[model samples]
Target: MKIAVCGFVMGIANLIPGVSGSTIAVIMNIYERLLNAISAFAKLKPSKEDTTFLFYLGVGIVTAIFAGSLLVSLALKAIPVVTYALFLGLVLGSLSTIIKRVNKVKPTYIAAGV
Candidate 1:
């Protein structure tokens, strides 16, 4: 379920401009897991478990891409502000998640980074 949700978030991130699905996975702290799972294929030596796990994330990403193209884009076309709001929410959510990852998040450092 978590992997599926991450895949969905990644798909939406990709669909939206100026957003990175990889960044979302990094924030979600699943980047390493996904990297291992996906890299196996490129390396041409995938383990059975890695193949199964990636299959799930792949299904999720593909499903979201299809749904977003079909439904989300249609609605976003009709209501453009909705797209902005969704993007804002994703960015804000990602920022919050990133802050949590730090041992002691510094406002000055974050401000500088931003």
Candidate 2:
């Protein structure tokens, strides 16, 4: 159930520009498990655990993708500014999560790159 919900959030994240589904999975701390489940399909033998986990996650992701598309489309049509602001917030939130994981920041690195 928890994994399903995480999948749902990941789905929603995918709907917005600049938000990655994998990044959402990483934020939820299921990135490695998700990756393993995906890679399992390519192996000669796959485990029941990976199959079951992917099933629930896939269900959530597919459900949200369909539902969120309609809702997000409506929101965008009705209130473009608010919808964009919400997307910006999602991007910023993801950025902060990434920043939090950084062990150190170098002034030169910041200065050297875009």
Candidate 3:
């Protein structure tokens, strides 16, 4: 139940430019699990847990993407500049959330430049 809500919010975040879906997943504490689930797709068979989680998350994300697009379109028609400004704010504000999710910074990671 809760995971679905989190996924939904992540979906919305993805719709907003500059607001990374992975950043929201990290904030929701599902980034590692989500990454693992996605990455496992290359294998012949993935675990049931990964498949189930991805299924629910995928559904939530797809639904939210469609709904959010419509909402954004309406908002743009009503107030284009304000809607874009709001998205800008959302992206800027999300930086703090992203920072919190950064547990550590190592030399290796720095070298990787990610």
Clashing pairs in 3: none
As for TM-score, the candidate ahead, 1 or 3, is: 3
- In the range 68-109, model 3's lDDT, one tens digit per residue, is 889988999999999999999987677777755569967886
Model 2 segments more than 4 A misplaced: 106-114
Model 3 stretches astray by more than 4 angstroms: 103-114
The local distance difference test score of model 1 is: 0.81
Q: Count the backbone clashes (under 3 Å) in each candidate.
A: 0, 0, 0
TM-score of each: 0.76, 0.89, 0.81
Using TM-score as the yardstick, the better of models 1 and 2 is 2
RMSD of each: 2.7, 2.2, 3.0
Q: Answer with 2 or 3, whichever has the higher TM-score.
A: 2
Give the per-residue lDDT digits (tens) of candidate 1, residues 1-114.
Answer: 777878887887788776788988897778998889878888999999888778777777888898877776687789879877887887787777777777987799879877
| Candidate that scores best on lDDT | 2
Evaluated at residue 55, the lDDT of candidate 2 is 88
Per-residue lDDT of model 2, residues 1-114, tens digit only:
998898899898889998989989988989999888888888845699999898889988998999999999999999999999999999889978976766887887567633
Model 2: lDDT equals: 0.88
